[model samples]
Target: MAMEGESWPRVRAVLAEIFDRDAEDILPETLIMGDLGGESVDLLEIAVRLNADFGIPVDEDAAFLKSLRYLLAESREKGIEPEAALRAAYPHLSAERCATLAREAARPQAAPLLCAADIAAYAAAARK
Candidate 1:
C-alpha cells in the first residue's frame, strides 16, 4: 500500500482529469463540489478512478466509505452537527479536516461533499 503522500499526486491527477482542470489546481483543500464544480456523477467517476488507481475500493463497501456514509446518515437523522458526527466516526481524520468536512456537509447545495484531503485520507485509511 502506498503512503498517503505517495497517493496524493495520483488522486489529484484523477480529480484534475475528472474536472478537466490542471492537477496543480487540485490542492488538498480544494473542494470537490464547492470549488471544483463536481456533481454526483463526477463523484462516481472519481471513486471508480480512485479504486482503479489505488487498488482500494472507494465505494460504500469500503470500511472508510461505509463509516462516512453512516456518519452522514446519522447526522441527517439525529440533527447532530456534521462535524461532530465526522469527528466521532473518523477519528483518523485531522481536527482541521473534521471541521472542513462538517462545514461542507452543512452546506445545503454541496454535492460530493469532499475535498482533496478527503481523498488522501480515504486512500491512507484504505491502505491501512
Candidate 2:
C-alpha cells in the first residue's frame, strides 16, 4: 500500500515493533548503528519485513543495498520524488490512500521478527 503524508512513521513503526521498543524511542535522526543499535542481520530482517508487508522484493545483493542510500541521496539531489524512486525499485507497492492504510495499520496483526535481549544478540553486542 502507498503510505501517504510522506510520513516515514510507518517505517518507524515497523522498525520499533521489530526492535521491541516504543515508537517514541526512535527519532527521525536516529542512526541504525549508534542510536537504534542494529547490525547487518538486523537490517536484513528489517528489509524482510519491509518486503513482506509491502510486497516489494528488496534485492539484498550488496550492489542493490549499497545503492539504496545512494539512490535516496541522489533522489534528494535531483529533486525527484521519493515515491518515484521507491516505485522504481519495487513495483508491487501501489499508491495506496492514507485513510485506507491507517485503517489497515490500526488492526491487530502479527508482529515482525522481534526479539528480546537474550535473543537479539546482535543488538546487545551493538550496545558495546
Best by TM-score: 1
**lDDT (tens digit, per residue) of candidate 2 on 62-103:** 212234445545767899765566446433233332222223
Q: 126 in model 1: Cα distance from truth in Å?
A: 0.7
Error of 2 at 47 (Å): 0.7
**Candidates' C-alpha lDDT:** 0.70, 0.47
Residues forming the 10-long window of minimal summed lDDT in candidate 1: 59-68
- Work out the TM-score per prediction: 0.70, 0.44
For candidate 2, the per-residue lDDT at 41 reads 80
lDDT of 2 at 1: 20
**Residue pair clashes in candidate 2:** 2-96
Which ranges in model 2 have alpha carbons more than 4 Å from their true place?
1-7, 61-128
Candidate 1 global lDDT? 0.70
